[model samples]
Target: MRGLLLKLLFSLMLCLFILGTVLTAFVWYVFNYSDDRPRSSSHPIRKNPEADPSGVCKECRENTIDKMVEIHSHTWKKQEANFKKFRSQLTSRCHGATKAIVTQVNTPLESKIVYDGEKRKPLVVTPKLFSTFLKEQPFKNVTWETCAVVGNGGILLNSSCGEEIDSAHFVFRCNLPPLDKGYEKDVGNNTDLVTANPSILLEKFEGLMEHRRPFVESLSSYRDSMLLLPAFSYGHNTPVSLRALYTLQDFNSPVQPIFLNPEYLQSLARFWRAQGLRAMRLSTGLIVASLALELCTNVHIYGFWPFAQHPHDRRPLTNHYYDNRQSKKTVHAMPAEFAHLLRLHGQGVLRVHLGQCASGPR
Candidate 1:
């Protein structure tokens, strides 16, 4: 009986192997002979040119290299010499490092906003209400040796700047960026202060009308950082910004929401306008950079390139480090902002990280 069972098992294994080999041979024959067609030498395959989502054609993209104007590796040493020198040019008197611009008394209510030209006379923040957000009040000691302002520009892709960025005494990232999903190496994991646009609240959280856990969970990555918002900048921004503040407060989140003093933003705009930058409004990155100039002794900016092309290889890049969403050119004069930042970089006021960050010479 044992010998008979062994013979039957051996026969089954051989049958299975023959069947697999036959199926493999049949599939190979079908794939190879299925699409036989006579090739015409004169009618060879023609490939379409690559399309640019920015709507620029190949010719236009080719000429963009010639139109590149900002100071770069090719031009920084040569062009910085031509620009006039200044001693730490600053605009606002209300940076955290020097003085607390918005304590209980100095909140600017009557100052006109940058975009709407309306006075913020109605906005108010009570001292009792503000003190409840953070019990520790860590910002009481405003002096920081070094700070990293991480902009969401696509130039940061492949920068490998996570370790360098996290090494700073404080790190500020604009618009809540996903630090997970393989992005931590390029964007870093630390967050001391993060500024949020009212539009982000509306678009991402549906104005926080329902299911608040996602919003609260997102704030967890920042740990005990401050959530800075331009609550009084625009008239429409007030409602949504307030909702965000409430969301954090209601959840007892570690992330504390801080409304930026409108007067500081106004002063910052006026200061940059005087510096020869032309735009409807300065970008958040520029605003953050301007504030960084005052808040820390050494400010290192990452991911701030404005052009679609990479600085080194000149390949096309997305509008943001996270996504390729099309940006409005008319809303903010991005090139002009980049030009000013480039000039500041030339002046040695702050360091801008253009390419990948390395252990040596960074």
Candidate 2:
């Protein structure tokens, strides 16, 4: 009787050990390997939508539908009001009438006479009309290609990166100057897309008209290119004016103006007004702009960090990019938010190489 009881106890211990091992293996598989498989109706496991569109299951679909309803009903209205308030602040602070004059004087022309007509002014080409024409123009079938988003960081200077930047099937920049002198030697002359945000343009080129002329000259170098524009808002008036001026000048380049959905802006406005949500909102515009360029396979970012770590101490400072002239000691400090951006870099969604490259000063 004693021997039989001992044998039964040993068997029970073995069974428990086996069960624990199996449970450990199941947990590991669920956390790590489950995301690797193809999702289908027949399969019980669901896949990530960003990795595989077909991985969505019935439950996930229902959850998405519910979330969409919540965003539209509860979130959108709140965002719209916040955006209006921000607009009001910009108008009141900047002096509405003066800003209007600046917009008018700098606005791009509607059309220009490219050819002379016998009686009426010859048919003109304007950025507004040019974009319309491009839409009507059908594109020939072509294989997908990679694109590089080059920032105007001094870091590219003397880096011998012109070849690399130009090697991409398509390249994008912001406000290319006409004369190819300073950092242009390494940055290259082949540009397929030029981003023209109204606020950025106004802030960068408001008084520097001579510097603006080269951008037009540079456009002449590329056979196919686009002047990217954003939809109008009080915060974006300056960039819009610069785009309008470029159009008025008859740069003869294709123009693509992206009108972001009002819903997206409303979300952004709410996010920005929130005490701790502004940094997330700040990068949302870049993400939105990147989405518009569906033609590009990969989009690399440069010179985007409003504040970058100083080389000596590795602390965030405002004195990196020439364009960011605002005092370093602003009312808002974004350390926590910048850390979130670094997390995004680790996720491989964007390549944020602000001061890492040794070509030039940031």
TM-scores, one per candidate = 0.72, 0.43
- Residue 41 CA displacement from its true place in model 2, Å: 64
Tell me the whole-model lDDT of each prediction, alpha carbons only: 0.71, 0.44
Q: Write model 2 residue lDDT over 1-362, tens digit each, in one string.
A: 99999999999999999999999999998999877778777867645553665655545545543443333232111133433444354334332222211121223246432211121323344554344322221112332355556655433434465655666676667644331545445566677656555554556555334466654543565445655444333333433544555553465545433322222344334443442445323333243323322333344454444333332233444432233345333332333443433433444433444434434211
What clash pairs does model 1 have? Answer: 109-120
Count of clashing pairs, candidate 1:
1
Model 2 CA deviation exceeding 4 Å by range: 1-145, 153-160, 175-179, 200-223, 235-277, 280-285, 288-296, 305-324, 327-341, 354-362
The number of clashing residue pairs in each candidate reads 1, 14
Identify the candidate with maximal TM-score.
1
lDDT of 2: 0.44
CA lDDT, candidate 2, residue 304: 41
In candidate 1 the C-alpha lDDT for residue 357 amounts to 87
